[model samples]
Target: MKPGFWIAPEGAEEPVNIFPIGEEALDASHKGLTASGALAKLASLDSEALARSCPRAVELLSTIAAAIGAQTAGAPTQLFRLEGLNDLERRLIDDVLGEGEVAGVVALPDGTLAQIQESVLAGIWRVRLEADERHDYVEIGAVPEIVSRAAADLTASDIAIGPVPEGTMNALPVLAEIRERALSWRPGQRSQTINFTLLPMSPADMGFLQQTLGNGPIQLMSRGYGTCRVLATGIRHVWSVQFFNAMDTIILDTLEVGGVPVVALAAAEDFEDSAERLTQIIEAYFT
Candidate 1:
């Protein structure tokens, strides 16, 4: 209450208003009780499947838990190959690790295809590599490593800026700016992103830049809440990054000249935490 305001009688003030603004307690106990009851109901629903899981499935779960523990302790990610898993075992694994929202499908230069899918349990990933042969793997991390590794090998090459066509006044300046930025770039430097979408450029200016920059082979597509595409430009390190809405409409378009776009890479700390959570999930299932 304000110093000059009338004092309310004992227990007259609303319990919520009694606490000053921004000072309310979280009151997690109420939520915790609700969550515990809900989880018990869910456990009852999955009791049959939990009991029916095969010994192989249990062994695989334990192995995954141990791998997560190692990863949490700053070890590299562990891959549990699923090649030998029978159909029933696969089903059991699916029952325990449901799908999550974040996933990526990338095409490697060798024509091999790889898919990384997160599980409902954060940090646990299902990674599948397909070429002439198929290999299935389960990985525990914040995000899959291949997504970043695939882009790492691409090197920036020199670009020969062509003469700016007539009627494109600012195109030459833009090109010069980009070339200067690219030449000065070094590893581990702060990222510099240029948003051509925001610039006042004519169609001819865009055409000149696109033709001069050219295109590179490496392309990455990652999906979560929406979609993001990173394509290498002929000028090494320079990439065309585009974000799209659920309807596939372009929302943001820009050029990133860096090792890789920050959004495309997962933080190490995130992986560490994911590993810990994954370990807990496995242990809880057993208990």
Candidate 2:
């Protein structure tokens, strides 16, 4: 155990023992997503519909698997256009790729917004790439490229330092550190996370921090026993990542300086597992 506390004067109330999560609380916040568990949730699909009419959907699944393989081998994401799908085809695709644990909104290239939802299988994402008029597509990758691009593009490099408002404590220094780290951060570099739960932050400080780094359009939710909401601030390479418990209490809060935080992105192992699991589902039901 790491034993450390703030050096304060006598009777100064250095209450820094912050981890109050009980055993039951910890148990409640587990990552309940299991590959086998996901497989068992599928009831009997309409075999006849998929076999007779949904040939294109079947081809798309196979293509997704192939693309996932490429992605595992470090290839760029593969996009399958969902344009011109008939009712049955679209429904089949939708029913098969039920919503997963991660969902978010990202800005499209044209500055419009698009909803990005992960499929039940990890690393498979449904997002509208184009702006205006439904042009949705499925991307098989660790994460959709648009998510990172939007985060990067929308993050303003210049963060202005204003006079510290009255009653605010340490927010200015924190902002300065964030600005310095964010401006110097580069791709493939290790990011820094400043934990606020351990800091002495006044309400005014928090307000000032939020006001200085205005919210960006990129917002994502990764659901588990609770939810980890990743919000991109207007400042470049700055993200506000907060984890809330079942009762909506923020168990952890931090500002991250770098590219998109890793909590929001699926991993290569996720892509591989998703590809395999979906292939198994297809073979068992659609074939």
TM-score, each model? 0.65, 0.82
Model 2 Cα lDDT, one tens digit per residue, 1-287: 11111112337443211122222322332234344544444355567666688788878878887778557624577788877777778767766777777777665555566767787787888886435435688987767878777777763797987778999878888888888898899988988999988888877787677778876767677884577878788788888888877875678888889887888777878877877877887888777
Worst 10 residues of 2 by lDDT: 1-10
Question: Candidate 1: what lDDT?
Answer: 0.60
Residue pairs with backbone atoms closer than 3 Å in model 2 (clashes) = none
The lDDT values for all models are: 0.60, 0.71
- Cα lDDT for residue 253, candidate 1: 69
The TM-score leader among the candidates is 2
Clashes of each: 2, 0
- Could you say which candidate leads in lDDT? 2
